[model samples]
Target: MVTEVRGFTDPQKEEYFRKRFRDEEQASRIISHIKKARSLHIMCHIPVFCWITATVLEDVLETREGGQLPQTLTEMYIHFLVVQAKVKKVKYDGGAETDPHWSPESRKMIKSLGKLAFDQLQKGNLIFYESDLTECGIDIRAASVYSGVFTQIFKEERGLYQDKVFCFIHLSVQEFLAALHVHLTFINSGLNLLEEQQTSSQTEEHFYQSAVNKALQSPNGHLDLFLRFLLGFSLQTNQTLLRGLLTQTGSSSLTNQETVQYIKMELSENLSAEKSINLIHCLNELNDRSLVEEIQQHRTSGSLSTGKLSPAQCSALVFILLSSEEDLDEFDFKKYSASEEALLRMLPVVKASNKALLSSCNVSEEGCEKLLSAVSSQSCSLRELDLSTNSLKASAVKLLSAAVESPHAKLNVLRLNICELSEGNCEALSSVLSSQSSSLTELDLSIRKLQDSGVKRLSAGLQRLNCKLNTLRLSGCNLSERSCEALCSVLSSQCSSLRELDLSNSDLQDSGVKLLSAGLKSSQCAVETLSLSGCLITEEGCTSLASALSSNPSHLRELDLSYNHPGDSGMKLLSAGLKEPGWRLDTLRSRMFPEGPGGSSVASLLFAAGPPPVCCDLHRPSPTLLISAVSAPWGLVP
Candidate 1:
């Protein structure tokens, strides 16, 4: 039913080449040149990779008569780096006193900048102050005037307090520099060892141990991408490019082998899979097809189990599996063990997924806390979450409230039915609903034993000017007249967005119904559908509702008062309202309305062009009337 393009096809590829290379002849020739490398051609499927490929190939064709095209991602990036450096050098030579070639001065400056990038990156700082430049032995004024390699990668911007701030043009560029700093550190250590007459293997082993230890010590995983880039740089083809631009002393092959061996050892030691997945990506960069294939085989065989994995590892396996699938509809956690570790692992997948269904998944307060942390981190992609029928109590609900208030949270639909929420939990939930950053639009708090006080707190949040909620379900929450008063305030507020409200199977009596009628009569009320089924309403409530319905431009469209004893008098009051010229209500439901001498008159007024009323059996309970004005002249009973 659907066509897939493994790589850019025909006109798309041709158009891409034409746009990237302005010269038609050069574009055709470059395309022909890269066609010899199948791996590079396949990578061109991604638009960014295609741009990098075109940039590298164009440089090679222009600068050298018969330069070989880069075949791998690492090789292409390395070539692109060289091209960028050369371009900067050319521009600098025309306007500055310094030599443009890879001289000792330029190499020293590069080393200083790399150190600065690495230090700042480790601290999770992407933007740097002027003091950061001074600490790195960089003269900002001079660098800005000369427009050298520093200016090419690092850009300057005006700051709020300080006059100037600097950051890498892209995070990837900063990552590359951080990795380069590590490689240079290893090279300097090797050079010092050689002066002491130590063997090359010993120096490499030390470097490998040092790099791996440093990477493993970062609990926040800040060094993971840097280590990956460092491994990529260890490749011979990539190192060759670096050698031409920076000073180097020893062979990188030993370092590469040792690094790979250290990673394998770590993986064999049962390290967390989620934390070690980046190592897999590093191996892919090294073109280690055999190891990648082995990992793939393990994944396909389902050899990994929850018992063998840490929460982090479970997260990694789920990510790998989801990436391989074409469509990820749902990740059922029911198949896994009900351990806390298993649930923790599922959190990452839940954060990354669009919709998650965790009904009866045995999640506890600890799991809820973990999921909340993920959501608050601003990295989670979850839009809908269903935690119905869980054992979560008020404490867990409090923990979840922090996530709901997060500005970065994307959740729009949340179901927390029967989660043992109480009055205390309602306070926390109220803060979430009232938050300006909240994205919640549909919420279900059904059958949670939220009594009158709980609904009162929830009503305060619903009345907030910033609340965006449109549909609310509070069935069987033990509400009363006091709760109805608070809800009326929400419905009467000009800023309220409420469209549908369900208070079905509650304890709201005739007084509560009269109070709600005031809200329905308000000019600001936008509610279109209302359900007060089994709420113990009587003729007095129906009279109040009839008065509200007679108001001009009422928004009420569907009303359900089913399973209640509205009586003949109540039916007559409702019938009078139905005959109002301004009344727009189209559907109404009620049960057990007593038939009397005036019943026919009430029925004729309610359904003007309908047939005679059906008789109700005394032994059998009459079905509730569900009036649909557009479809039939009279109410339909089923």
Candidate 2:
């Protein structure tokens, strides 16, 4: 789908103006003005946009003494129309600068062109024939003048058979002109082209409401930009720029605010991400930034953590993240609010993020349905998902299991910790991991009560050659040696890809340690980090571990034995194992012993195992290994 048709660079744009304009200072001044306006500068990249900018900015800068200047898209297009008319008048009609730009004849021509633009745009037809022009009341003779006055705006070309066909210079030009046509039709004659039904009391609010409805109903969002321009034209300053086209300018400010309010309310509805983002754009065009500004203020002051956000603010925050160009490496759901409604409202962020952190958010089964859509979607960027602590049940996780088993999904890391899983949930997870399509490398099921039965189910997946899991965390899972027996099978299997295993805070006594050490000595064991901290292990466990390390301990780099009953005797076994020159243990975390000579000798021996073997002081409260599984802040677009 990609083509070599990228727009002009900044230097190319400046060079374009310099070549078009005879006076270099004037060209420099115009480039300076375009640079000041970020949107305008970005638009100048397109070659046709450069022409439109040249036409619009040249006149506006010269008439710098104007009553009001153009800023929004609606205002700029309005000025573009007026400037085209004025140029035609002076060049061909010998009119002065002070001449009334919108003569009756000029209005006729522009209105006809607007009608053509609107009608053709509605039909999704960018190119039209002469017959199509006549339908919009543009005779062949008037079309000549149309091509002459705004040749670039309304272009003429030959078809395959050498017959003449026509289209606007760009699709954006057609959309802008169509929006102007809709706005002027409503303003001058009170005709609602969007809807066939006319209410008894059709205020500016209803007309705009109809326009919004029509745009939202378009399946492909064909009228999205047109709707933005149409709504933006409701602003009073933009109306002033359209003075030549308007016959009525007395729209009440109260009614405009009502329309803005209506748009914000629409934002809170359960709309698709694309529609929600477009509605936010419409709100911006109306100059209503109250919701957006409030969210920004909350995020800036760290007050979002303290207060609850309304539905509208949640949509605004989503708009900020979805529309940003920054590399949103993470989307933290709980960072905003833990409300289930907020999580559901912002599910679109999951599809947009490289890694989404939705753990600990007050998510529901319905939220899982929404999350499933995002994850299974073919174009989503989500690779890592942390859905921990939402307290979801088996049925909810089964829904997520569907996405995890899909070949198209790119999910690589999944954290379902503390989600209240049963044996059935583990069965579903086991199937997902066993699927050859699954790409998950790290699975964190920590803090769950998946007992021996559940661990047996997961062991089926760990033994599958198709399963590619490298890090498996079952910390605080109420496991016993029976569960460790199942894991021992997995660790000894050459098919197991597990390099890191966290079985911390378990009831795995010496029996479990011995079971695990037996697997660690397997030539196929790839585990580099093993965390058995707080497990009920004493001297007997230490003897087994030391003997296992003495035999084949090259694969085991770091071992955690903290907060256990591994007394002085166990320490001596560990110290003896450390003194062995065969193994290369990088980090060893054991209990902090008392200050007796016997305890000091064991401690110093374990520490001073002469080439300064890697060790860890279990005293410093295990440097928070994870970053709350939540990070990467968002901001409001300026």
Candidate 3:
């Protein structure tokens, strides 16, 4: 008992054009032209726009020159109007339709339909009852002509509960017709209905200012396109297409310039993101890309960093980023201005990108609320987000974590390294890692003060069966032996999925390494890469690690013991495990600090564990085998 209808997707849009033209080359030509005007191609998602575009382009391509084809939305609507009028003449008079020859009767009917559209549009009514039409002074019988070519006026087949109702094929058509009526009334009588309170002043500025204000006041922005169409009428080009319907086709060029300035200045005001984007669209409709072009100039010149971008320029940058065909990749905030406001204005850009690097911009708490929408957006392609060096509050972290735990989240990698993370933030992220819906596989919370408490909280999540994390980085978290106990539990658990662990630059002295060795020896441990660089380890710590390698060396493929004072005694113990009969560790990475005397002997003997034959020369130490860089897997010690 329920029915659903939706607009065309990209494939469906192409399919409609292919089916309508029935010529691959012809359809491709029309498609190519629309694609160049990105805004027009976006609108083709609607079936009604596609139909109207086909109608206008079909004749334009055949008769009109290259630049004569409609580029903006308003121009396209105007051409559709002229085409529909000419079709009416041909269908009834059986005459060769050279141009639109509007009879008095046809003009009267169209004008009446316009009034009906304006009246219904104000009340936000898409469907009209029989009484609604009569109230607008529209003769029900005369309205049927629009059904033939205009595609909508009275769709009697929509028998909702056996009652006659009327509506446009699309809401945009109604808005366009309504705007047409307003333009006609204004150019003819200098009357302005857009103004809530009528003023004696009839300046062009007053008319457009009132329209913009009214559009901004609407809660859901229902009047945005209507405002675009209304302002677009000021241009002489859009007006010429409706010359037959207008009392006068001529418009003052000064008035057009004034309207453009008024709307462009509104961009400097503190408007919502939605309002800013709509204002940009209105500028496009007015054929004013001066602001956008100016920003493009500054961007290309590489002088954007030398000066602060104004709010108008910032919005234009957002518009330019979104308008490009190169979406669905990555958005790096550093490429644009480092201003937080400008970065936040680019939510739509982030929504389309698969990866986003928003590091070090110092996003505020309120900004995190804005980012929550993008993080949780089901339609967004965002898979990886790096918020490194952004000092986020615990409350902001909670909001982001909740989104990461949502079923709609597609986020796979989150890097919060050097983010001033706290225990409270760790608790929030722990929930995300434990969530069944979470897709997070890699996490970096490096260079913070998580200590023992944060690691314990995180260990709970890592031990959960639903946790998807395989790579975890906790470098410079100020960890100690207490932290090791909690992580050891996670490493030995059957539910843990941890494969790569980084504890570099933490103060996990000999005691911590012993507890970690207990976890490493467990048969359930799946860790392939373990980094313990700059952990203040000693010979005692190396002894426990040797036993762990001897007990279980099948899983550990990479061991990093760079920057530690493992003396001759520790190297003697470690070499026994590395040379065990069932040894499988191929990537042996160790950096030993000499103790007392004969430390060089210990360094040369340490290579006996697993280095290649070239690196195993005891007489000369190979530079390739003595890597101390904890930045990555830098070298191989045998």
Candidate 4:
């Protein structure tokens, strides 16, 4: 009945010198596996700079610490460079070189580490979680172990990715500034690169060479290397990647809007009208949901209206308006009229193919209804229909009722934001929301005059709705505790598939928050993100929230409570929950405090450090708070 000893032995567990050569080999295998997993995470990000940076850093650290480099260095390095080469091929003009040959030393490192790591994986003896906190506050995670080197290196590489992306944007801004010099000092500099190219009357290669030479002769007025690089990229790239870089680089500097404008104009000047149109279309095609969302947030209605877009850019605008339907429920349409005419003109082109585009055209009931009906009859692919600021009386609600119930309804997004709808309309819209035809994913009813009675009317309809409606925004909806109770009841019921709920700018205080939290505690709530900005709740409300978050919980990953003025006390209360491992919060972004010195706003306090593993961002008000505030457990200062 005696069990055979098979696991790691005491000799292997002892100090490096105490272990046999076999034990050392076993430990190395474990380290190697961890390095491979870490490498996957790093390789996911493109442009091998991060990997290169990590390798160089590892080399530097090895030099300083007088230790051997990790066994998997060569494999990680090659994988990193391969990613860079791939991204470069797609992003850079003239394409990137491949099959780069590493040195013999590198090859040897790869062969040695690859075999060792593979053997460990095959043996199934790797420890994925190898660190824990010691008695002192300092985390004792993998910092001293041999594998700790690669883990440290991976973190540094990830950090390098962030820094490099940030620096790339900054360098782009500098290039824009260099281009701006053309408008200031260089406009009449007697030497224009474009003009020089046009009139040189020399061989194309020689002329371009001279132009590059002249461009780089002096930094005083010359474009920086980044700009030169950008020009080269645009000249040799295909339509898609070029357009992506143009949109990204152009939009990076929102503060320097004028500079961005100039750069776009300069780039456009070199292209034909057709190409410019396609470029604008490509910008509209930016399908990276995250980046587009960031842009939508920063660029508001007023700003968009004032921004200049040529006739060719209109189709792109139409596309954005169309795609916006997917989440029109969250938008505040009143803020987006930017030259109503420009928006109106694109509607027809967008609606040309939809027979249901202009349904429910009863102008007598409400202006919004008439517009909705008129568009319903058209044969256009109308994805988003914005009627936020209009009086969408009972008639408009009824129009939507039909569209939502019809199985063939093409409408996926319907925005009724800021509409002054009555209780009757709410009930009617509830039917629409519950209908099988509605493919709505996002619905923003913020700033609507919906009272408790309205919510009560719609609760049943919401519970029965089968649409994949993940994001629900109801900011400033005049919801009371009673309304919250009813809503919570629905959420705890069968309709528990929601992912995000934004209840900002509402009248709900601690009582409402408590009720919502209680409902969320139910097993039926599958929400992943929540927002309660400007709810006027106190620190005590946060205590209730913390309690709910720390409890055996749901899938919540992000929670935002911006503009709530909860102060330090409320923040501390939330921090308590964050310190607990039970809490599943990942992105806790908020802008709660006032701006600090150098115009740094207090919103940056949300990401400030405390005792938990979290990212503190105090940059909204100013990044200076990280310097001046008392450092907390989250790693951010107040």
Number of backbone collisions per candidate, in order? 1, 0, 2, 46
Residue 264, candidate 4: C-alpha displacement in angstroms: 37
Model 2: lDDT to the true structure: 0.78
| Pairs with backbone N, CA or C atoms under 3 Å apart (clashes), candidate 2 | none
Per-candidate RMSD, Å: 10.1, 9.7, 6.2, 24.9
Q: Rank the candidates by lDDT, best first.
A: 3, 2, 1, 4
lDDT (tens digit, per residue) of candidate 3 on 556-627? 777777666666677556555455547666555565433323333332233243222322211112223333
Better of 2 and 4 by TM-score: 2
Q: TM-score for model 2?
A: 0.71
lDDT of each residue in 396-489, candidate 1, tens digit only: 9888888888877888888998778889988998898889888999899987789889999998899888899999999878788888999999
lDDT of each: 0.69, 0.78, 0.78, 0.46
Instruction: List candidate 4 segments past 4 Å from native.
Output: 1-348, 352-380, 465-467, 565-569, 593-638
Q: In terms of TM-score, which candidate is stronger, 2 or 3? A: 3
Residue 277 lDDT in candidate 4: 28
Where in model 3 is the C-alpha error above 4 Å? 1-32, 42-52, 65-67, 91-95, 99-121, 125-135, 138-149, 152-166, 198-201, 377-379, 406-408, 492-495, 517-526, 537-557, 565-586, 591-638
* lDDT of candidate 4 over 1-638, digit per residue (tens): 32332322223222322232245554454334333333222222322323343444344343345433332223333233333333334343244343333333322322322222222222332221212112212133322321232222112112333421001112222232233222111112323333434442333333333433344343342333323332222222221222221222212223223322333443334332223323332232221123234435535544554554444344344445443323222323233334333333344443533322222222234444434453454233456665556555676578766755555445666667766678898788777667665666667787787888988887767788474666777877878778778878766776645788888767688898889888777777778888887676777678777777766354777777765556676766665455456667655555443434465433333334211333343322231322112333333445
How accurate locally is residue 25 in candidate 2, as Cα lDDT from 0 to 100?
Answer: 81
